[model samples]
Target: MQTQTKTQFDFIIIGAGSAGATLAARLSENPEFSVCLIEAGVKDTSPFIHIPFGLAFLARLTHLGWSHNTAPQQELNNRRLFWPRGKVLGGSSSLNAMCYIRGVAQDYQRWSDAGAKGWDWQSVLPYFIKSEKQQHGASEYHGDAGYLCVDDLRHTNPLSQSFVNAAEHVDLAQVKDFNGAEHHGLGFYQVTQINGQRCSSAKAYLSNAMARSNLTILTQAHVEKIIVEQGRATGVQLHINKKTLLLKANKEVLLCAGAINSPQLLMLSGLGPKEHLADQSIATIVDLPAVGQNLQDHLDVLVQYRCKSNVSYGLSLAAIPTYVKAAYTYTFKHKGMLSSNIAEAGGFDKTEFAGEECDIQYHFLPAILQDHGRSNALGHGYGLHVCALYPQSRGEIRLLSKDPQGELHIEPRYLSHPDDQKVAIAAVRKAREILAAEDFKPYQAREVLPGAEVQTDAQILAFIRANSQSIYHPVGTCKMGLAEDPTTVVDENLKVKGMSGLRVVDASVMPSLIGGNTNAATIMIAERAADLIKQEHSSA
Candidate 1:
């Protein structure tokens, strides 16, 4: 077999997801540096790709989604839960519901306290605002001039309004903004949309820089391993069009391949735990035992209720006109329900756990989200998803085989901890309580999922263990912190500690998952990492 030719770049970024795209675009701003961005998936060119309401059609889409599955949870009778991550240009940001949330201030403060220097809430808040061009007027915490557009939801169903009112009725204080100084109350969700289309990472960051001459983007390029030499990372060995190619990095090689792939790539390149690499007959370059450990994700329980009125998402036929009106508003005037995110409203609140900050987040939907693959709603229905903000259940990603092309074993171990299950149960109970409030009396007809018959805590617990699923927030596999921290994969500067010329700039570096939607935080991390890399380059 003939070996393919080699290419070189000043910086090689793997995976053009939320972080990778933003990092590539920002770093390539200076025409002096050459950047190569490789994506395993194809371009973001589908007509449905831009539609805000089309994400549901794109959810289980395999061509544009990795559609990862966890190694059956022992707690849930060994059920392997499906994990769908975007494999296309924008990554999960492309396939996500597009809720734009920055999470609580203390989430970052915890990162700084955990040895991630300069990553406290105060220091990182600027990056969040800098990346957000809020449709509303600018505040101290939000900016109006940025690449990513954050717009208010346009077509909120009456069912959604009733849910928010129910939350308030249940004494969950009504909050105007979750991203503001206080993040403990019910409020409307701000989404990543401009006009009626999704403002994905490709549309937000990559589109603006696509015409640049110094940047080369290769799609359908599956990287097999990082080509590290003499303890210094160089580039990657990738398979494109059934041919192997060696791409070299002149300055640095950044891994934005996400949590699962970043760690998997490291292991494939012999940059992981020594014994584990040796077991697979791969020479160890770095004995980073914590490379694939410390994995965390938010498990959400969807508490669905049937409505008395004909105001549920089941009215898709009637809602078509509303969606049309929204499309018209955006198509002509750059506003309306077309701009509305499917998850129109939500909030953050605590469970009276005596924590300094809120530890629970809710995604209030105006439709029945009870069904896993599909739904059969009898009448107007809505779902209130209760998600545990911080999880203690740590899972790990391991290599299934020595070959770089082999599938990785991801054991997310969801609900492994009794505390996680307990918290989740409590959250759902709270959701049920909220559903019982008078605010919902106007719209709600009855309890559907748990049903009026199943009222005991034991019954709810059983239902929870069987039905709870991930909200798609996965992080901490390649955690960032001080070198001494056993789980730390990268330093405060976002550089891999035991390696040179390599950095992990994605959700993988998050010490823990944020309080709410992680897409915004992932983008912010890349925005900050870009500056960090630039400063390091300047000093060199």
Candidate 2:
């Protein structure tokens, strides 16, 4: 990779995370285009990022993520929620739980029905298969040789097995593969891992691509704004340390800065709501009213239980020996407890209020998840993370100032919609039932979060309002839809509305949040986008 700063490139992809890294790799493969991938954080050198189990530890480490929080949510008792977005090379893919979910078929169908033409399930499935290198080899739904590696977990806690059994006991059919036919049942999730180590987008897509002469990767380079000249996004202005530099894109400037930062970058470039930009004294290049609207996220509510034995991955004297053994095994062979993605297993189920598809998703953790695993596990415990898939509430990403370095506020009005609130309540009730099933008889324990005393639906709702958090799947800020929609930022091809030589190629362009983890969908978007860009330019 050429690190010497170049003023121009065929394509400038901002934010070297999941989509950006993948897009850079695929775009540069043509050799007809030179791509520069810009990242705000340093490389993904942290051992915690590569090791699967280290995701729990990586959560508390703020340096790896954007430490931005949402504005006080009135619906959640006026509480501010912290959002951890990957600022490093692979972006959130490096920090996520590694669940390789492509969401259900209906998710893509909804996207197409909502004006994102050609994004239906039938159209997008090939892209998902095209990007996946599944450990189980090539099948109708999986690929053998692709950038992203998907594999089964090498280690799973005994308690996680009980959770799966409990799901079966409760009549939620056993799912052999969550991504195989449908995500309607319960089962262990496949992760984006290769031989126990995380196969992040940076590792999968950018590792080899960075060595290409046509690709340039700029680390620790914060993009301040996109430079739009006469309504065309020409390039970007970035800052490295105290030095300010301008890089131009000969063909297109791609904004892959995830959800929070992508909209902020757009607004900073004087392309957001004119009135809001005027408030910050920013000159409006385009009066795009919906630039930062339509923000959506999965508000997660966790049900915790104290384990009577040391089976859970918690800090204890008894676990010392286990950890020691795990350390030894992981040090040399990369197998054992250390290889376990803390969220070892998860499944999907629906409540009575749900439609034909599942309404709630469950991530079963063998250890206690405190504040997104920020807190060290004090005692032996287990938890179930339940989230409503399709939230009806909407939010926005607003800028605090016109300065490129100003704060970007996230206002996720979680549980504001009555339908979402209904789903949340049902999710908690269903979670309790699953926990109390006969399958968990061996590890029978007491509820830690919403205790037995808090059994009523009203009480459960109150507890959820106080304790629920973001599942880290924020998307749809710069919604992708037809230009006729007032809240649309990018159109079917992901090009910015009324703007030329620019596109938003990240999670922000999602019209709605998918049914499961957003990482796989984001990577698939990049793959499909690379083809779109290639086809468009090749014909141009």
Best by TM-score: 2
Q: All models: lDDT?
A: 0.83, 0.90
Model 1, 260-337: lDDT tens digits are 899999899888889888888888888999999999999888888776666655554666675577667777865654
Question: What C-alpha lDDT, on a 0 to 100 scale, does residue 447 get in candidate 1?
Answer: 77
Candidate 2: list runs displaced more than 4 Å. Answer: 1-3
Q: How far is candidate 2 from the true structure (C-alpha RMSD, Å)?
A: 1.4
Which runs of model 1 end up more than 4 angstroms from their true locations? 1-6, 315-337, 370-379
Candidate 1 lowest-lDDT run of ten: 370-379
**Model 2, TM vs. native:** 0.98
lDDT of 2 by residue, 1-540 (tens): 224557899999999999999999999998879898999988999999999989878978888988888999998999999899998999999999999898989999999999999899999999999999999999988897899999999999999988888866688887878998766777888999988899999999998998899998998888999999888999999888668889999999999999999999999999899999999888999889998899999999999999788899999988899999999999999999999998877889989988888888999998886877777768888889999999999999999987766678789889889899889999998888889888777776889898889887889889998999999999999999898898899999999998999999999999998999999999999999999999988644
Q: List the residue pairs that clash in candidate 1.
A: 312-380
Best by lDDT: 2
| Model 1 residue 112 CA deviation in Å | 1.2
Sliding window of 10 residues with minimal summed lDDT for model 2: 1-10
